[model samples]
Target: MNKWLQVSFVILTFALSGQAYTDDSKVSLPDDSIYHLDSEWVTQDEQTINIQSLSGKQQMVSLIYTHCMHTCPTIVATMQNIEKKLPQDVLDNTEFVLVSLTPASDTAKVLKDFAEKRKLNQDRWTLLTGDPQDIRSLAMALNIRYKKSDDNEVAHSNVFTLLDEQGRIVFQEVGDINKVDETVARIVSQ
Candidate 1:
């Protein structure tokens, strides 16, 4: 009975951890179902950018406000971690975009200051804040929901969408601070 109990314990452990060599495949997003960036966006840097602008580059899109005290910081940290983990080729071909949903609050100066404060590479990163209506429309199209809370706070989704060179969302991840490296790697491989 003791030997049988040991065997069961081992089986349970494997089941709980998922078999290490079970030939299980990772579930990837379909090419056709991805949400594509279709419209032109005005950047916080006073530049107009279109979806086709990223035709040859992979992009990671996330919704964040510079004023956010909690999750937004985590999102920024996660993005930095992903940037750090990418290979040189991936880093060269990829761009990180942060679209501010709080357009009424985060202005160009604010975004510029925030980017500088974070020491983000301006060439590889874009933090955008523009027309509130446009931001809302884009957020809805991307399926990124956000609502303003009390006193300059917001309750928002912590999702990051990785888009391919053709502007197709290849992967979606939530709570990126912990899984950012894996998410970036998965998208980079495709």
Candidate 2:
């Protein structure tokens, strides 16, 4: 009877452990993950990269145009402020992505120049430009609305999108560019 009890306990332990391992191995991204979008982008260095290529890292994304005289600069400054407040570890794991609304004018060289003028960190920041249709598709996926005016300036709303390591949008802040403390707290806690 004692030997039989020992064997049963061993079998039960093995069965439970096997089930747990299977569950852990089957972890998957949610259906609505933004990584599912099939948008390709050209980096400031002229390298072409797909949105999924940004997977495995947390990302903060914004839409902007280089020619804007008002809101774009403020948006960039807000991003810079957020970066400054993040802890070193969080900063290391995060990527700041700026997608150009004026893809026709904001070529790789233009994007690179804008980054340099702003003194954005080359390693942590990525500025992208691509086909106008592709850019519009990405904007739609993120729910960002924008349109070019008769004067060629982009009329758009201000939104900062925060994506998790899997590219799922975990948080988003609209308007009030300076109200980022909650966003910072979310990043730190995650």
Candidate 3:
């Protein structure tokens, strides 16, 4: 091939790849809708972590507890699958976070253990457990609802929210946890 044609082809390839690698969920959100964090959040680590701290980066947000026997696991598994599907370049820029709604049941030790079992990247994934009231505050802000059972089981929404780089909510899915892949693709591509 001629040198000019070869260089042109390489540049075109890089541009196309970069476009393909981005998460485009921002385009999916209603044009008038805004994405913003409701309040500063404190973690069970006794460390303060404001949702605004996540600004300028794409993020996947979900609610779960370490002790759950069923739906929670499915939620986590779906999240892991989403991570796997994402390109490495996008994955590095994106963060996956799980908020422990059952603060009492999800201690730091338990969250650490769960992270270890799942082989999740400590830097990339955050398992947060704070006061139940704080959890409720955050949940309400995210439009997530849940109830505690007498037997220690908790029933919560199976929803996941994808926030764009600007901290605006892009997509919210409420149903089978398996749909995370497609929902996330919309965010990453935006």
Candidate 4:
């Protein structure tokens, strides 16, 4: 009876601790935080989440569509390379976001297939597609520009943005991705 009572007490304590940790007692976000945007996004695995849900960890974000035959692939490769250069602790706490510039075509299923083919680590990488307007809003917020051509191709800016836990921009790399690893490590260490 004593052992059973102790075990029950331990379980209840853990349950309460978890609930408290997840409670809605978060501090208010600043005016410029990207998380303040009311946009709904679907992940590669078809889970429906939002920008705010991505708030806790540092976010390294890029814009790409899976079907692109040009710089988009390079962008993905660059993100993977950045992941390799991070220290284990920073890598574990950081999340990579790839937002589809062609959201009208890059459905959740398509994103999932792309992720599988590329062997992207689902635990650390998020491939997202959402309504076109939402994608545009996020792109504008991050200072990434895009225009769709008649050939079904998108001419887009090559920008990689880093957002801190509260969704404020820590750094943004434009065109040249070679510096991301070093910048990320330095900012995170500081």
TM-score of each: 0.75, 0.81, 0.72, 0.81
Per residue, candidate 2 scores C-alpha lDDT tens digits across 1-190 of 6999998888899888875333321246566777666578999999999888887889999999999998889888888888999999899899999999998889999999999999999899999998888878778878899999877799987887889888888777763555767668878998
Q: For candidate 4, lDDT tens digit of each residue in 1-190?
A: 6999998888899888875333241347767888877689999999999789998889989998888998888778877778888888888779999999887789999999999898899999999999989999998999889999877789998778889888888888763567666765665674
Every candidate's lDDT: 0.76, 0.85, 0.74, 0.84
lDDT by residue for model 1 (1-190), tens: 6999999898889888976444211123234423243456656587877645655677888889988887888888888888998889878999989988787788777888888999989899998876767777767766888888667777888887777766676777885577976776686677
* Lowest lDDT block of 10, candidate 3: 29-38
Q: In candidate 2, which residue ranges exceed 4 Å CA deviation?
A: 1-29, 175-177
lDDT of 4 at 25: 19
Error of 2 at 114 (Å): 0.2
Model 3, stretches more than 4 Å misplaced? 1-46, 174-177
- Listing every candidate in turn, what is its Cα RMSD in Å to the true structure after a full C-alpha superposition? 16.5, 9.3, 14.3, 8.8
Specify the highest-lDDT model's number: 2
Indicate whether candidate 3 or candidate 4 has the larger lDDT: 4
Question: lDDT tens digits, residues 121-176, model 3?
Answer: 77788878776776787677668899998888889998777777766677777646
Report the Cα lDDT for residue 161, model 3: 75
